[model samples]
Target: MSSEVWFTVLVLLVGVERLAELVVSKRNAAWSFERGGVETGLGHFPAMVVLHTGLLVGALAEVWLLRPEPPSVLAWSMLALVVASQALRWWCIATLGPRWNTRVIVVPGLAPVAAGPYRWLSHPNYVAVVVEGVALPLVGGAWFTAIVFTLLNAALLRVRIRVENQALAGLAA
Candidate 1:
């Protein structure tokens, strides 16, 4: 009935979606490994997991603790961004297919995919990540979580993108 309750429901839904992604990612990772896929960037994987989990937890914590009542207009706009980010994220997954595991695993001798959202952006999923990092929390008026997640995610993405580029380069070679 309340906006906070709705926000909690939304966050729980997102968490469920993330679990579904993990299921797909695990299956895809297995597919890649079977195909001689080489995984890089293991080092940051733990940090990424923690930070992402923190994003959800922190949003809830901040909202319940701080109790900021974001205006309806702002909340609606941020919700739109969150939905858009999810769409883009799923687009990336579909385009990459079995190649879309969360880890940076690249199969040798395969060509780089330039289709779907990848046609325009080298890391479109990261675009979704960045947007959602900020927007999701703000939807709950969790500004602190939004700012902290954005900053931390930026640092993590810097390492992630570099590792991914190198892995992709191996495919090219």
Candidate 2:
């Protein structure tokens, strides 16, 4: 198979993985809501969804349109980063357990989680997200998609982190 075919398969697998995450997230959201979790950052939620979906779609589109042939070294390195990011993302989810969801929802009176990836960085999942944003597209030699997603994700993360912190603060209060 051509590199483009392989790249398409990889992107499709990632999309399936994302679907799995949404399933987990939806269940977790319900768990939080049942426990009186208050959700913040509603306004940005749609944008987040759109941007992420765009990442997958844009990567596929760019790869096929441009038909870039990245060096084997660059492709392999980006692929490694993509895998690592997925691992880190799942680590965050497992650490948070039922508390982990796509949206920022905090149950009152519960202390913030300080275990797992959180032990090192406050928002380790975003680190995974940032890495994947750049690496996934480049794995398929889609540099334009990588650059655009990275910039947009950075702006979105800025707002997301602020809202999440405030929600966590409310939990502490």
Candidate 1 per-residue C-alpha lDDT over 110-173 given as tens digits, one digit per residue, 9 for 90 to 100: 9999999999999999999999999999998999999999999999999999999988988888
What TM-score do all the candidates reach, one by one? 0.99, 0.98
Candidate 2's residue-wise lDDT over 70-126, tens digit each?
999999999999999999999999999999999998888789999998999999999
Give the Cα lDDT of each candidate: 0.95, 0.95
Clashing pairs in 2: none
**Which clashing pairs does model 1 show?**
none
Error of 2 at 121 (Å): 0.2
lDDT of 2 at 69: 96
